[model samples]
Target chain A: MNSAALPGFDDILAAAARIAPHAHATPVLRSRSIDAIAGCSLHFKAEPLQRAGAFKFRGACNAVWSLDAATAARGVVTHSSGNHGGALALAARTRSIPCHVVVPENAVAAKIAAIEAYGATVHRCAPTIAAREAACARVQVETGAELVHPYADPRVIAGQGTATLELLNVAGPLDAVVVPVGGGGLASGTAIAAHALAAECQVWGAEPSGAADTFESLRRGEHVTDFVPDTICDGLRGTLGAPGFALLRAHAVKVLTVDDADTVTAMRLLWQRMKLLVEPSSAIALAMVLGHRQRFAGKRVGVILSGGNVDLDALPW
Target chain B: MNSAALPGFDDILAAAARIAPHAHATPVLRSRSIDAIAGCSLHFKAEPLQRAGAFKFRGACNAVWSLDAATAARGVVTHSSGNHGGALALAARTRSIPCHVVVPENAVAAKIAAIEAYGATVHRCAPTIAAREAACARVQVETGAELVHPYADPRVIAGQGTATLELLNVAGPLDAVVVPVGGGGLASGTAIAAHALAAECQVWGAEPSGAADTFESLRRGEHVTDFVPDTICDGLRGTLGAPGFALLRAHAVKVLTVDDADTVTAMRLLWQRMKLLVEPSSAIALAMVLGHRQRFAGKRVGVILSGGNVDLDALPW
Candidate 1:
């Protein structure tokens, strides 16, 4: 749990073994149209088709299963009402343990319904980050549930890394592996995985111009905590976690930022060309490549499509 | 191309071999949430991920390849402004032959752009069916190009059947194979493939209630062609072809119709739950299963998501 000694590929391997039976080995998709547009051969690791419609399930599964039977019996709690909460809820269901989600009062009904559908109790809190954290703390005190901070947890990062591990194993050596950065769980894990598996492969992080904290942090040589996020990518509005930042800093991962407009265009292109319903955050990875075609031209690049939980009524286009 | 001399299992086998070198073996997707909602174990053969974003490529590839070298050297032509025209154009390109497409003047610019993007020369004609046919005939005469009908041709039907062949071959065994019916190209081909590969498997056709000619014709034991199609499923607006009808009748393929509203709802649900961007026609197949749960409940059902060509600017929902 210490940033000084982060989890390595060994922890990722252990997470893969722990979550193998519960998690899906999602398909790797390729599109000639996309290849032509981006001027690169793209291997899309489709985590949108994962158990909870996101890669968060792998980490949630590992974190839930890592607990001993006695500790897991008390259940787990998280301050997320997004993909992580739903994933955690489903992971808890698999272990037959109680799960509590602290959701902001303004969270979408459909998302809350999805989390509740996984049989997790929902606790409503004010929309502020502090309020959500306080509510999560209250749940932890009341139910004696273990808190699984969405990205800061080392087990969650290790679980997320397995996606890149599987991608490298299946797609073989690649020019680079691109991932969308939010709290940096997936990006840090992927950097570690690519380093451990394919040393020759470069690791890059994509961020929305609106929520470019990760890019600015890597640029300024330290984490920048203060920022007002403004991005349509709901799953990627959180600040980068300390543990995830340490890993990214240690690995010297290059972070690229794309405008929200380009992210929307990329998302539309993905839906049209690849027939994949990926979120705006996931599209940023491809946007980064398309915007930087000179760098990735004629190379086989692996991109992780993080999630697919979208509100149909409130479409961006 | 003749109704009396319809294609059978042998033709499908030949088609599989012919298209193997050109077409993609698209992945079959599974979703736990969809299964829970539909009360069936569904194996979705995702043809949207196929080349040209539809199963049309399989038949187009088969038709182009079925022609001898001398005949293919001349070229290929078709009257279509949808997935079929694009598929034939790409197929012709693969064989290094000129492709001519006769499109109605009122066809969407996006559809025409996609067809032209594949290097097909577009010949504009009036929106009337007779004008389109006359234009297509002119192209055939002038360019000495073979006329490949969208779904009526025997070679095309056999080509379409290969999608089901691959699905059955990969998904192992299924209780039934469901497909969307327009001109019955995919439906009849799937019926034939199911008969050949899995005799115990029942084959059903899904159609839009607004365009229920296939259902009416099968119910009345004849081909019916005097009705206007009125559905959001643009891919399924055409009448059932004579040869396709004959094959369906011979195989006794049952046709079920779902309302356009239901098809749209199903399409939205697929995007939300399965992370798939499927057209309304493709969604009808799953709508049928969900609408008639008694028939598909507790069974392993195979449904072909026929295409992913959607107008992002004008979504039905």
Candidate 2:
């Protein structure tokens, strides 16, 4: 996808229009207690409560809805071990289309159940990225389904940008927006939206210190991969896709890394102080702000709580 | 605590007006997925997000605010192991009054810290119901602090009623309202409000099976106590207070009980399905609705998620 020629804010608005009836305009929450602790006024955009239990629903719904009747009739397929599979499954269910998800056998049982519950066919593969990709390709070849890459697709990015559009509309102006980077779908969308709406507003991506592929990639001015991460943030384990990396480079997003312990502490603090139930992946942005307080001290910060689909019985802490 | 001449709905409305500026009118959430699973439309009045982190704050704020200037100048005292202590402490801090909490030594470290963080002094006693009361009495005698009983006080009940008033206003008429029962402040207030607004609406009290003293008392037509509860729902261990029992008896409220395992399951399900971080005590109401599905099938049921103050690391599951 070309950054200069890619769809802009108008595309985001159109995506919002297309998916408005299917998605929830999740509320933006302000926390005085959190503000006092952070020494900053913090606005939390609660995308955890979005349909299919994450912000991925925004992009998935848009991607599925943007398909013409003929293409939608051909069905859709995606490879994911995170929120995107469940989101796309639910979105395809809404459109009465057959959805196939290629998931690793080691995927979280609850998430896999959620995907199946949304009426999608699940194709299990070995617990390797290569095996998952091969399974998805096989499914596409066998069924002639249109592939929707979670973050690499253009429509998905536009859909994800609508979250920031709504956030800015509700929270007014902020000095900075902090987003957790997994494959950078949410971060790229937020950066693009922030640039379009408030150019001066800084966009920062928070990644797990263990999975600092994006951080290293941005610093080295090239895509990084082949390094294994041992982070508790299950959702932020993927390397950035090419489109996401290009968008991040074009936007010059600042990248910060937080360790597993900081993510756990941040998750606990959110539960204790903010009364929010967020996955460790969502805690990455919060961990960045709290663990590296000097960079954000006394500044108005907007943090996207990306998702809350955590297994309470098996919390990482 | 006269049951024969209980204050009218107008008095409750007055309490709402007095506390509206200080209290949060927490958002009401509707879950289509929960509706599908339960075979009923469910409306959740999220008081867990209330000021000071529980519906208890509504009453505590009202109780502290309703005090005469002379009485407030003297100071205030209450005995609680849960949300009420922190709420009253914060409420008293607002008025620059000395607030003393008589807490059991075994009270969770987090709750104790919250009470102290709000600038209230805590007097620790042995971990028993009798010891807690004795400590409160001793403090009142020594400091002349006005005793603010956690649930038996009429002012406290009136303040808690505001939550139901706001719920009804936002969600409109519902066929039934389900609230958790401990000392019954929230349940009693909810019953009175539902009775006043829509006489046809049924109000039910959800109690843990291990702590079903309220169920026994209602059946026997008198208050019952002395039963030791072994439930994981620590917040629902209290025997029903005098005013709370009288109001519940007079209102003809139904009592439903759920086991501890059900409560934990409900807690996890709420986190997974509803994206709400609630304690085991709060999950009891959802447990009742889910465990006793036949009673709620095809009806509009409103549930009060009482609070979200939980030790996530040691969640009772």
In order, the Cα lDDT scores of the candidates are 0.91, 0.88
CAPRI classification of candidate 2: medium
Q: Report DockQ per prediction, comma-separated.
A: 0.88, 0.74
Top candidate (DockQ): 1
lDDT digits (tens) for residues A126-245 of candidate 2 = 999889889999989999898988887878888999999999999999899999998888888899899999999999999999899999999999899768987888889888988789
Error of 1 at A218 (Å): 2.4
Tens-digit lDDT string for candidate 2 (B201-253)? 99999999999999999999988987988788888988898878889988999
